[model samples]
Target: MTALPQMILTPLARYGWATHDAVDRDEGAVLRELGRIGEMLGARIAGRAGAIEETIRPQASDDAHPRSLSAQFGLNALPFHAELSHRPRPCRYLLLGCLNPGSSGAATMLLDWRTLDFTADELRLLESAPVLVRTGRRSFYSTLLSPDHAFLRYDPGCLEAVDARGRCALDLVRRRLGSGLSEVHHWRRGDILVIDNWRTLHGRAPSRPSSGRRLARMLIDA
Candidate 1:
């Protein structure tokens, strides 16, 4: 169930992402399959995490797994953000393998920040903007788009404006995305998509319960 990670790595610079076919794949046993695949790609499995993979499917926010993305967002669309952005340091890469394509309405959405052309003034303001990001009982201040790293750390759900600049930056970012500039990653059964989590913002489009769409996700380190 694993793809050649090196093959995906080679073309990532230009494609922003890569894909490999699982070929004659079966959905019933892919959760453990993804875990094994994640281990092959060096998944950070030694932390507090209970497992190295997750199954994404439609459910109510009040479901048993309330904290899950499937529960929080349900069949609705999700906002653009990196995986694990709420953590102290997000995962470096992500892999998503399609199990069920559903009714075809559930597509993965992507927005590459490197392609955004921010004005010098806006960039300057963003570099200085400091927002308090809350993660449960923990919180930290970050500029979101820091110059020290190529990655972007952002999640609108938890950002609390710390100052005028932070507030402006937050509003500005929201407006920027409001422009509707993004790429759509359509999925097919047996297809695996690899993403550089640090370099791209990703989300999900709407789905219907009847579609039966499902995807397996895994996070790995560099």
Candidate 2:
């Protein structure tokens, strides 16, 4: 009998995705590995990379996904949304590494726009629209549009909308919640998953304490 080909999961045709086995216990090693991968992938996809480093810790890093937004100011959740960082320079690649893997309910969820339900216009808006994102008394301009990326911050204070280019992306995302695009996977120790910020969104489910801990290192290639 012939053996099957190794089932390697690539991010997508238009995007790049990858996962690496991890073994470092120190935060610095995790960050360094993440940066190395980001640099390599960013050079291939985005042609260049900005700065890559460990996200500064915030106050609400313990709550599930959105609730943790305050403390995880620059970190992203599983199965959540993404886009570019600055204007006209969408983030083309993203990399996340699992330093510690929690047991049970701490799975990361993912959603692909093509799998979500939306009208042609909604789709276009998500690809090229601007969003008004509020981080606090300080608000930064961003959108779901091309070349625009955002760190999924958990600041209820943080909100986003297209300045004037479009307004339906978020609306459609909310409306399409039940389309079954949701994907969930647990990251084991030494595991890494890289995603195309433009084509995928990720978030996480709640988790209870276990023998192992959960520390994820994340970065972007723009």
Top TM-score: which candidate number? Answer: 1
- For 38-121, candidate 1 gives per-residue lDDT tens digits of 666665532224565666676655652534455557667877877776677778778888898888557888877766777888
The digit string of per-residue lDDT tens for model 2 on 102-202 reads 45536777766556555667655666665666534444555554443232211122345645544455556656654655667676756667776666666
Off by over 4 Å in 2: 1-16, 23-32, 43-52, 55-79, 83-90, 124-130, 136-143, 147-157, 160-169, 209-212
lDDT (0-100) at residue 187 of candidate 2?
68
The alpha-carbon deviation from the true structure for residue 123 of candidate 1, after best TM-score superposition, in angstroms, is 2.7
Clash count per candidate: 0, 31
| TM-score of predicted structure 1 | 0.83
Whole-model lDDT for model 1 versus the true structure?
0.72
- Quote the positional error of residue 151 for candidate 1 in Å: 0.9
Clashing pairs in 1: none
TM-score of each: 0.83, 0.61
Q: Model-by-model lDDT, in order?
A: 0.72, 0.50
